[model samples]
Target: MWIGSAAVCLDDKNRILMIQGKDLVEWAVPSGGLQENESLEDCCIREVKEETGYDVQIIKNLFIKEGQAEGGIHYQTHYFEVKLIGGDANINDPDGLNI
Candidate 1:
């Protein structure tokens, strides 16, 4: 099983932030697998910054999503609502999932 974290960011206009992977045509929340020795909240914050170039702080955890994929790979994801702190909007995904 794999565990991951996702960020739910909102602007002053109440619009939710979303990102598109370089290889994906669909839009999705900024998310990533939790790194070793990292807290779930830290994982969520890191993913948002990496994917969207936005520094954020966790407001609260929203929910958890668990399921199995076609390959029977079980996964658990933690979602959190985060507040924007600082940083310019740009893509800098280390996974090269952004151009």
Candidate 2:
């Protein structure tokens, strides 16, 4: 099962949160694949922190996207709108992601 999440985080000023794509070299929202032994909510929180260093609270789910790839790998992604609870915003890629 392929499961992942992406967060559409906005600030009080209505500015959207974005990150430079580590692979694609374009601006994109923060997202990541789910890890073992963690809830989906936890994955979202962790991914945001790992990629952008911002702590967040998942307000609610926005949508769910499911599809199949070329090799017939079924993939699912959960999108969420989040609020900033704390933490600074900056790049802190744990996996050394670079464009």
Candidate 3:
């Protein structure tokens, strides 16, 4: 099983900050798998910044989803509301796929 976190960042105009995911190429909230020893709050902030180049402050957990895959792999995702702090939107990452 794997645990992941996502950030739902809202802008001043009430627009949600969605990224063009590298793998899925779909517009979705910034999210990623949690790193070892990393807190969920830190994961949310880091994932958002890595994907959208926007630093965020997680406000609260919004929801949790759990499920299983065909290969018996289980997954859990935690979603949180976040506020943008700083950073410029950059959809380019040389070492990995980017939005």
On TM-score, who's better, 1 or 3?
1
When sorted by lDDT, best at the front, the candidate numbers are: 1, 2, 3
Query: Could you give candidate 3's per-residue lDDT for residues 1-99 as a string of tens digits?
Result: 989999988878999988774578468788889999999989898888778788888889999989997899999989999998888987645337745
TM-score, cand. 3 vs. native: 0.86
Model 1 Cα lDDT, one tens digit per residue, 14-95:
9999987667789889999999999999999999998888899999989999999889999999999999999999888688
- Which candidate number would show the highest lDDT if scored against the true structure? 1
lDDT of 2 by residue, 38-72 (tens): 88888999999988889999999999989997889
Write down the worst ten-residue block by lDDT for model 1: 90-99
Q: Would you list the C-alpha lDDT of every candidate in the order shown?
A: 0.91, 0.86, 0.84
Give per-residue lDDT, candidate 2, residue 81: 92
Task: Return the TM-score for each candidate structure.
Answer: 0.93, 0.85, 0.86
How many Å off is the CA of 30 in candidate 1?
0.3
Candidate 1 achieves a global lDDT of 0.91
